[model samples]
Target: MSRGKHARRRANRNRATLEGEVAALTAQLVRERKRLDQARAGARRADTAQARLTAETAAAARVMAPVEAEATQTAAAVGPACTVLTEAARELARCDARLSRAAGRSADPARLRTALNTGVRAHLDSVHRSAPLEYHHAAFRRRRGVDTPLCRTLNVGGWIPPEIAGTDHDRIAAHMASRAGEHTRAALWCWAVPPWMGLPDGTDAPGRRTALGATTTGAPDLPDGEFGGRLRAGAVVGTPWRHRPLVALPEDAVDLAYWYRRSAWTQNWHPHTRPVPFWLGDEHAHGFPRSQPLPPGTDRRLPFPAVIVVFESGWQLPARHPDPPDTRAPTGLLYARGHGPTTPPLEQPLYRLAPGTRRDELATPLELVDRYGATVEGLIFTADPDGHPTDEFAWCLAIHHPWGLPLGRITIPASRRATHWTTAIDNTLAGVCLAHFHPTATSTGSPGADPSSANAEPHARDDADVHVLDIAATSPTTGSHRTPAHAAGRAAHLRRATWRYQPVGPGRQHRRWTWVRATIVGGRASSRSTVYRLTDT
Candidate 1:
């Protein structure tokens, strides 16, 4: 036993004692934690049980209250007044059944009318006449009728008045018809296409109407007729049935008569100042040539978007159908056009007069030449190089260009032995000249031609480049409505053709760099281009 050895033994004993204390304390902490978890779980269970009791108490109260309320309602329904009304209703049903047996299956309408002279209809007629005109007028403007609301309110207390009950069908139907009318009248304004192409005013008024497409009650705001009130009460104006002509039309009117059918069957926008738009930017546009040599003064170098319209005729009938017997109705080409590429006239899928070939639409008015004489034509848009809007024939005259490409030519079959594109508009030639014609500085020499086509002319040689004009010296069918101002507004449309940075990379290039000139010809599009690639010489 040295002093150092004694000190080491003391240290070992002290370390062992501290280890025992630490192990005992850890065991006590574990037991305390286990007790805490158990106590918390017990509290949660107690809370859940209390909530369940509260919910069950509320549910029981809810269930009992309805049962008690229903019992009270049942007693009230069986009161003396209800008992009397129920007996009366049963009596009426018995009376009606007996009346049916006595009257036989088909009662004579005249005799029935005579017997029920002072019946429900008569009473309703008197009531209608007595109503202040303003009240009924509101029905058309608003969505309610006077008699309908009166009938409803009277029946609200579970008591059906006999008069209203007897006339239930008539009143209810009138109310329903009035509701059907509310949308169109309440809409403020909209347009519909008339079936007949030769209608008096023509077809198509643009956004001239209010967004709703309703009109301001024309002429007088108040009714002005022999029986306007009665008519208003009985009929809803602007409805297909109510507005239709009562008398039938003759066979000659059959084609135009198609408009009298249901509104849903007729054209959607019609009955306007004219079929073709009066103004170029109006709901329609002029025609632009796809390719042509400049007529005279036309600047060929100035690039602009060439445009044309593609639209369906009034009806989707064949490109050429039998003209109506009424020859006075102008059987030749009439154009019906509209504004926009949105919802363009898509001819339904049908068998083309040719076997197996289906053309969804007619490409141009020229297509109808041999058929119904290609009387009617329509165009959508047209513009020239100086940002000026010019139509097909006029474009050539204005630009000193010759009509090129397809040019919507109506070539006469050699068998017909007539000139191609001889139309009524070409008054000069009865004999065949060019199927189409354009005003030229040189004489066509065949028959009746414009004076401008004869004698020494500065642009006579330039007209030779154009196929349409070269066909004959006769003046081409220029736009009936095309004006110089129309071509002057070309800047707006030309802006649309300027180069835009397409979101394209070299990897996804559908096209390479090239000088491309574009034009919209009728509904089809074509371009003349010269491609170029970069190279180091």
Candidate 2:
């Protein structure tokens, strides 16, 4: 009970005191932390309010700026005219507003007229003019109208201003008619089919040309003119409407007429040069036998994606005559060469369509051929494979390979012949072809490719591989004044427009191949999609 017991009691009391102090301090710290959190939340609210107010202030300033600027301008314009009469002051204000609008938004008439004149000049340069005067004296005289009595008498050629001629359809007709004689002018064109089987030996008979079955005929009345009979092999048939004739050499009588229509139609519309015959090389025409042997020394390996053009002959009236007219424009067979396989053209859907069943319901040229039984024909006007950059045909041909698979043949029924294809349709074809030929070429997934795939590449545009070639345009008809020059100028005005991509995939494949549809319009594409894959039945 001594000094040790007293020391233990004192130590316990000290420990209890220390515990009370620690509890008090912990409570105070909790209160302080709560206060800090509340303050921070309030600060966040204030910041949000400040940001909203700043946005509102900026919006108000923007709204006021235009009014303030107009007021300042009005004040400046009213200087020194403060005492002017009310009417005069009002007039000044109107004039100032007009000046602002003209400077900012309105088109200048002078600039527009200058642009039009430039286009006309460019057009005239492209047109084929009569041969330059043979002699210097003749050239001088011709310039003065000494040699152009017809031009002077008819008041055509350069005599009539283009403004008047272009506006007045009748005057344009007269101007064109005056340049060419009635005898030379084509009344109606004929597509004389060559007898590919007439050879003594059947060695060269590429089974009946599958593509040549498209006999385009119109039900309309025949134009009033002599339908020229079969001409000699060397004789030229188709002379353009006005310009000098560009002759096409044919190997046989039927070939002569076919070239005649080709030359005539091309010259009348294009009038720039001869149609370059593009041959499908051996690789492209592998399974399809040769109707006639390739031209001597002609390379069989070159890739010419151009298809044969089948034009509707005015002489053959399918509606009137059950069988194609045999007397004048004989029903000719067109053979399309195939690259991959040799299939029976007659067994294809195009040839197997129910008799008298026309494809009026199908929308695309390809659909008409593959689904509804149509035949393929090449383009009427052959474009130079290595022609000018802006040449519509050349551009189409050059880009076709990259954009899509070869349009082996084009299809159209005798009943549903069209002038041209729409821009959307043409773009769709490009997309379909691109999807088939260069499936991975586009940034956008190829048609029918899985969209959600992690490995799928990005797409640059929604249109996939389609690109705008030119605006839709029509070629000049028999008496129309439209020149190749005008077509070229119009093409320049075309702005790019996007066509949405439509997926054409394995579902759209066909067994037999077809060609690209050819139309009379200048820039519009009316091509059929050729079957890329053939399924064994």
Candidate 3:
């Protein structure tokens, strides 16, 4: 019994110790689990941090990519020329637009060409006053013939009459022919819209008065103008007023000038007495037939020959304007008997229309030409008047001889008239004579003239090709002259009729002879032709 009680006591002690150890182990396990959970949480946070860092790095690369690309492009696109190119592009755009607009407008080609030349004309007076080299040296050393002052300019072609041409435009050939006379005048024709050209009131117009207009030349029909003033769009091709040779005026408006001369080459002026007139919609064909094309300037067949004119004019005191020899004193007896007290003969009178003269008449003279030198002058200039906008002016031109132009003496029967022209040949004879004629519808129909043969053989003289000289057509002879094509069809016939002289020697011949060639052009081929013989040398 005593042994059994001691065993029970040992068992109880062992149980208590085991229970305490179990509690201590449980606490240790709990602490370890807590530590492990904290470590696991830290690892998860580290993974999230790594992922965020990787995302940020990728975003930063994306943000920098476009900037880098732009920087590269900028570097490639420039050094320093970029600014210049940009500015140049802007300027070019502006200039191109301006040029395009100018080209589109229906402007006179001549005026457009002379845009720069206008500066010269506008400032010619100032330039002359400075006594530049052009003024002093350009006169070909020819004296300014005070003794026999002569101012002359060649006349440009005129508009074809509406009655004959049915339009404003005439053939280049016909335009040149009509104004070939030595005394041809210069006048330009213009058209008017509903609003006619208007002139300021009270301005004097030197015109032959009509029974109706003498008192009725009153107010503008329309406030804008009487006739729509600006030249019809595309009405004419060349400058509205063909090359108007600028006149050298004095610096002071009223100052007198000394005699001046110009022996210089120039295109001749056109008649200003009456320019060719036209309505708004006239059928004026501006083309030449294929057979007879207008030749280049190099051709001798040109109607208007290149010429050097000896133009001279100026105000001068008479060589001897001695006060009429004091009629009451010394030469009274002779002066009174022969001629009544000669009121000191007036000086050579210069003629120009009063400044503000306006006209709508076709026949009245726009300019005056007397014996004293006054050749080409504009009567009135309109910068911007009613109806007409582009600069316009009336002109007076004189047709005269150029230096070295061959002189001719022609004799034709009164019934069969012909226009005559002459040009000198190289020391062979005096000159070649040309006769102009229009088509005459005859009963006997003639063959079609193959004038291509005429141009086939070109004569060479003095290292230059000698081409056919020209003669202007005369006024209508018989046929109802219509289009330029019709006129060109009836060309005058040509066959050389050389008049020979006495053969004096081998080289020199004693010949006062005449020459004639009957030229056939247009469609008019004739069976026979009348010949004219040049007489005077």
Candidate 4:
């Protein structure tokens, strides 16, 4: 076409092309707007999800705190029973070692035998003093002037001693053999003194009869006083007989007076202490019959005293049952005579007094008043160094709190009586008040009065504090005229961002977040995010 025609045609074609380009651009713009809207919607949804997650995390944290605190407390209280068991095991091990050493040293058998014999003799003596027959027979002979030997034994290995000969010896030997073994017969020997006898030299005095009708003096054969008569003859017969160093009597006229005096003296003097009157019956006076059959429904009560004097070394007077009545006599002696000239005014008072007049009361004046008030009962007293009746020491005392908690122990000084009344009162009040006022938060397992049990808890409550964070995003972008510049423009055009988080519990859980700035190039998108989770204070 000519220059004019060509320019016009070109113009028309350019106009048409430009129009089409405009329409395409418009369509592209609309598409981009829709994508942006979609991205915005996605971002909103992400934000919503993150918010829900944050709420859930906070709720969980709230539930865990108290549980954690309880767990920590429980761990602290379970450590004492283990400690006691460990100590008990150590003590048992020590006792075993001592026993082993004693058993190993058996070389000096003679000395050991002597020691054992001495111990055995001591045990036998204790048995005799406690035996009922020893007391009853002694009483019977003194009253009737006739000796009825409980045991008739004179066997000495293959030889019979000259002192225990005749029909008496044979009867005694037969009776002893029936009760004990042949070796026992060989080891044992006996001598009988005619009525009104004395004990052998170095022998303990015979037990004295002290009741109202009991004999106090020697019979006709031996005129010297019963105890005095026994002191002179050194009677080895019925009184204080020894198994070793056999005694033989002359076959002819026996020295009846000599034996009588000896027996009397021996019966009067106690082996452990000076001569003292036997007041109470022997310990075995209340023994059960071995061979005799009892009627049905026999109610046997223990015959020994309930409270024995426990020495520091653990030896007790009358160590076993059937103890001699006069053994370990109290320093002060009081006789309970029938209503006669010797009886005291307080012996049987018509009305009970605040303090009973018995000389051997166990309780102290203060303990009786504080614990039991002023209701007076019969008292038992032990003598002081000077032989005066004194109050007894309260050995053990404990205080219980109102909630049954036992707080502490009160130790008293060694004395016959309590020094002051205030000590017991103060201890009881303080212990009870403290336990009642402050209910320990520690789970005391029981309401019983044991202070130790007042602070324990079961083991199931521990939790850790936590924080949460959730992030979500959606974006739409387009690239098409397809140049790097165009892509960059699209990337720059649309963007949505959201950050959400919550503390794990109602209390604030510390949290920190850092956002890393992003550098955009071309149409590509990138995000940089960081979160720092922390604990609750």
- Candidate 3 lDDT over 199-231, as tens digits, reads 212233322112001222222121211111122
Residues 338-409, candidate 1, lDDT per residue (tens digit)?
111111211111111223321222222222221233211212122343544332210000000011111111
Worst 10 residues of 1 by lDDT: 394-403
Using TM-score as the measure, the top candidate is 2
Q: Per-prediction TM-score, please? A: 0.15, 0.18, 0.15, 0.17
> Candidate 2 on 379-435: residue-level lDDT in tens?
332323552111132111100111122222221221111223222222322222221
TM-score of candidate 3 relative to the true fold: 0.15
Writing each residue's lDDT as its tens digit, candidate 4 over 226-329 gives 22212212222221211111111221001222222232322331211111110101111111001122233422221111111111111011111132356421
Q: Is candidate 1 or candidate 3 better by lDDT?
A: 1
Model 1, runs deviating above 4 Å = 1-108, 111-125, 129-537
Q: lDDT value for candidate 3? A: 0.26
Q: What RMSD does model 2 have?
A: 29.9
Off by over 4 Å in 2: 1-186, 189-257, 260-267, 285-386, 389-391, 394-537
Q: In model 4, where do residues sit more than 4 Å from their true spots?
A: 78-537
Q: Whole-model Cα lDDT per candidate?
A: 0.27, 0.30, 0.26, 0.28
RMSD of each: 32.5, 29.9, 39.6, 39.2
Model 3 misplaced regions, further than 4 Å: 1-357, 360-367, 371-537
